[model samples]
Target: MSKGPVLLTGSAGFIGFHTARRLLARGETVIGVDNLNSYYDPALKQARLERLQAEPGYIHHTLDLADRPGMTAVFAGHAPRRIVHLGAQAGVRYSLEHPESYVDSNVVGFLTVLEGARAVQAEHLVFASTSSAFGANGALPFSVRQGVAHPMTVYAATKIANEAMAHSYSHLFGFPSTGLRFFTVYGPWGRPDMALFKFTRAILEGRPIDVYGHGEMERDFTYVDDIVDGVIAALDRPAAADPDWDAAMPDPSTSGVAPWRILNLGAGRREQLMRYIAVLEEALGMKAELNLMPVQDGDVARTEADVTETRAALGYAPSTSIEVGVKRFVDWYRDFYGV
Candidate 1:
């Protein structure tokens, strides 16, 4: 009995490309979708797609998630049993400039996915969330149980809305859905917008790098492979209505009546920004000229993940240290760019 193909959005994006590749390796038919917009460089997205195109089990569509009719057609045509909705206009700082893009892709695009999931009665729906949803909370190692009522940025607000929307769909349609709050995902074939890639490129080019929060910030910095492990595990185990869920003191991580839950997918260890830079410097063997700056709008000083629920539920453990991870990224960057 072959379950239908997995419909994966953002297939050309960094994490999506990795997830799609792993799925293909495990013999899963992956139906990939991505607009390949110029948010960063479309060439990078195209490069990723070229690799996936070589895999026999991979199918791709160049469509935006917000395109409701196109997405509906895909669901009807493919009949996907499971969906990994990873497409969104991603960027904390960019949200400050173009909030509409976040609303269109994250809000409107999410609605189309929920509709498609309902139409197919998807066995499981796993979507990407962000740790930035923990905005305005100075708590260490953020837990899924913490209330996400104060999202400081439009991007975070849109992801938080996706959780609520999925929960309602799960309750009304009797399908299972899981949301994963990823913390600072980075690795080979990484996005240029991320701190890791930017720092590496600047250091290699002998350019000064901007150190936000005056180099005092910290991040959980989960590697791409670890995140993919958590995603596949969560996808395999669908959410269920919590039997012991109490409405009096509702658990933010699970639902009382709905088969819906959220979990943190992170390394569960906080590393200082300076240490991460140092690791990158060691990898490139070049020191970065630092321009210390105040934290930008919609930026949190520090972010840590409490992945206890993730580990207990999915047996998830993130093993990559900054040293190994930075080295891998630098090696890939050099090879890819001929630097």
Candidate 2:
């Protein structure tokens, strides 16, 4: 049998770009796909893609996930052994303005990926979910076992739907699917739309930064490298059906009949919002003009991921502190933007 390609969708997006760069750095054969939409700045995505092209043994395919037939064609042509589905409409507040964007990209796009996996009979499929799925649970240290039925935004709801969709596919078709619930991932080459990038830019530009919930919030705030480590580890070990799964207990995190599981990829610690902003201030040597406001719709009070299961299953240990991550991010921001 010919060696199957390793496919990575969202190859130009923040997380996907970083993951692709890491894999290529290790002399891995990778086939990357992306639409390169103008959600923030396609120029940034293009720059990342250019960097990837410099790496040897890397192939590129430009396509949108909503293009069902185009997606199928890419899968059939490459026949990847493993798939990373990371492309999606990402943002909590923006989801309100563009609900259909979440539906088309996160929901419909995910279905296309699942279909591709089944068509190629891919051994493993790993995709990105979000901590926002926790919604108003207000629970400290959110675990994989927590109930995620209460999504506050269309984005979170779509991610929750993805987990359920993966479970159904795994159960019915015996797919080895792993869903990673990432919590507040940040670092270099990050999305301009994310909080870190926005806050950093605002602080440096001497503009007012919105401090939602009156600075009364905490987030797991995981670093991007840690998230990638968890994802790569999951790829090494495909999700397997839980033999000890009990129907009486009905665990929401695992499946007894399907080779499917959800893992929380995070730093396993929570920090207050203003504390995170303070780190940015320290790193950038500038202070943010604060616009403290009441909590907006689809906003959560706090998000803390319990990564015990991730550590146990994938040997995942998040070592990047927010202080370190914020510094790294600011350094990259200034260098990339030439500020």
Residue range 1-339, candidate 1, lDDT tens digits:
236799999999999999999999999999999999999999999999999999999999999999999999999999997999899999999999899999999999999999999999899999999999999988787999999999999999999999999999999999899999999999999999999999988888889999999999998998999999999999999999999999999999999999999999999999999999999988998888999999999898888999999999999988999899889999999999999
TM-score of every prediction relative to native: 0.99, 0.98
> Once superposed on the true structure, which residue ranges of model 2 sit more than 4 Å away at CA?
1-3
Please give, for residues 109-174, the per-residue lDDT of candidate 2 as tens digits.
999999998888779999999998888786678988989888889999999999999999888888
Model 1, which residues run further than 4 Å from truth? none
Task: Evaluate model 1: give its lDDT.
Answer: 0.94
| TM-score result, candidate 1 | 0.99
RMSD of 1: 0.8
Query: Cα lDDT of all candidates, in order?
Result: 0.94, 0.90
* Residue pairs with clashing backbones, model 1: none
* Candidate 2 CA-lDDT value: 0.90
